[model samples]
Target: MTTATRSTGDDERSAGNDDRPAGRAGARGVLSAYLALTKPRVIELLLITTIPAMFLAERGIPSLLLVLVTLVGGAMAAGSANTLNCVADSDIDAVMDRTKSRPLVSYRVPRTHALVFGVVLSVASFAVLWAGANLLAAALALSATLFYVFIYTLVLKRRTSQNIVWGGAAGCMPVLVGWAAVSGTVEWPAVVMFAVVFLWTPPHFWSLAMKYRADYERAGVPMLPVVATPRQVSARILVYTWATVASTLLLIPVTSWIYVGCAVVIGAAFLVMAQRLHQGVRRGRGVNPMRLFHLSNSYLSVLFLALAVDAAIGLPVLG
Candidate 1:
């Protein structure tokens, strides 16, 4: 779901590096435009959480082929949802400084073509997941796509400041899809990991939103930072950051000292950074939200990587 525009959805900003107009360029340029529509970096972040869930479910390495299939299907599902968001949000994207380079806004590709591409990817994701994994996995992947497109993009985004909080649940579905791919059902440990990402989404996006508060304000999007004070926003980030760390510990029942050790250290760093941001905002000193923004990305990456490694080495703390 990228916080659900990452379209996390961190506005799923454009994959293209610069805002230079594409202007219906050649085949390679056209191809790149389509790729940008998928929001590859955000998809990459979503998948980072996915594989570790599979590892945790299997309690070790899953079949490499299963990992491959799930990643492909999950990427397609996320891609379809993100592309459709581009079509729906192109108006605000054109107005927003952070998103002006996106494919739909830039006219590098036709809107109708991007829409078709999105729908096709969803269908393909279902087929691939159904055939290669289980129907449950396929269904969960499709549901995430539908929720992100219909609920988050169309319904809640412009209407509420708490938009990303609820909308980000769609982004958490990859963990469900991953766990279901291996075990064929959702379990509590999987649910805890889902909670971690769900909680992680807000602070992650809001930090970036702090960096681009004016863009959101200009587009009339009621992002928390746009509507709330910097201190208020950072306070909320601290709350979510604390909850994210607590959720990581919930995996304690299923994980070993390895995972526990990593979670504690990384989570401490997350809190330190978050607290620093909060203190800075409170004091009206120079606060770089982007520092926490970049750190949050690395934090989730390291947390999930530790989970995968803990699963791989087969060191469980409990039965």
Candidate 2:
């Protein structure tokens, strides 16, 4: 071929190769973005509460299928809520370091697409839980979704420092959903489990807010740490930590000694970490507070797991 012809041919070939990888990467990015919208970590935490709640509500092994269905429904419902939250907060998210790369904010996914996906997922979750589990479970899941999407994200998130405190109720509903899934009704033990998670949410999220207060402030999100001084936030953390511990211990009346012991030890360690975070803030240090945050995560997971184990061993502490 002539020189120009060969150059043109090479350009075409290079363009073809470039297009192939770009297309593949684009597809992968879309898939990953969609999954990110699900808030998998949040769903995992929510699901952790489910198994324990089921155990606390059952004398014998609960229906494995019902547990599975409730988990799936809860995951989908929570994911949908998170996705819609992202869409609604896209503007603020774009300004915050922690949320800057979220699909809605980064334009990795369109707002309309995310909104539609969220609606579809929410509807499907309700259908699945209602048909596969029970109406009570489905209604609770639906209510949780609405609370997160509307009450938490829309009304409370920007309005007050106590946003997560009230919004946390949405997060705690999964325990009731799980319990009702098998028992078809709520019980005192399930209420205790709900209280445990309800009280746990504030300290868990407040520590994270402490670590990212600057981003929250810049985004005008009104998180507790952003609205309050570091010392004030730290004090709140300590207070909430105490409340969380107390609530977890209250589960002893409804759970086995194994769970109670786990809660006490974990709660004590959590309090220590919170105290350390408080001291750091008091001293004008800008520490990450990861110890408190990480410990809180572990505390919840292990506490619920203990309940599951107690159930598996054919023991019912309260029932």
- Count clashing residue pairs per candidate: 13, 0
Cα deviation of 243, candidate 1, in Å: 0.6
Task: Provide the TM-score for each candidate, comma-separated.
Answer: 0.92, 0.92
Query: Which regions of candidate 2 fall more than 4 Å away from where they truly are?
Result: 1-21, 284-286, 316-319
Worst 10 residues of 2 by lDDT: 310-319
Q: Candidate 1: where are CA atoms >4 Å away?
A: 1-25
| Candidate 2 lDDT score relative to the true structure | 0.87
Give the C-alpha miss distance for residue 43 in model 2, angstroms. 1.4
**Best candidate, lDDT-wise?**
1
Write the residue-wise lDDT of candidate 1 on 119-238 in tens digits.
Answer: 999999999999999999999999999999999999999999999999999999999999999999999999999999999999999999999999999999999998999999999999
Indicate the residue-level lDDT of 166 in model 2: 96
Report the Cα lDDT for residue 59, model 2: 56
Model 2 vs. true fold: TM: 0.92
Which ten residues in a row are the worst by lDDT in model 1?
8-17
lDDT of 2 by residue, 54-160 (tens): 87688556888888898889898898888888888889989988888888877888889999999999999999999999999999999999999899999999999
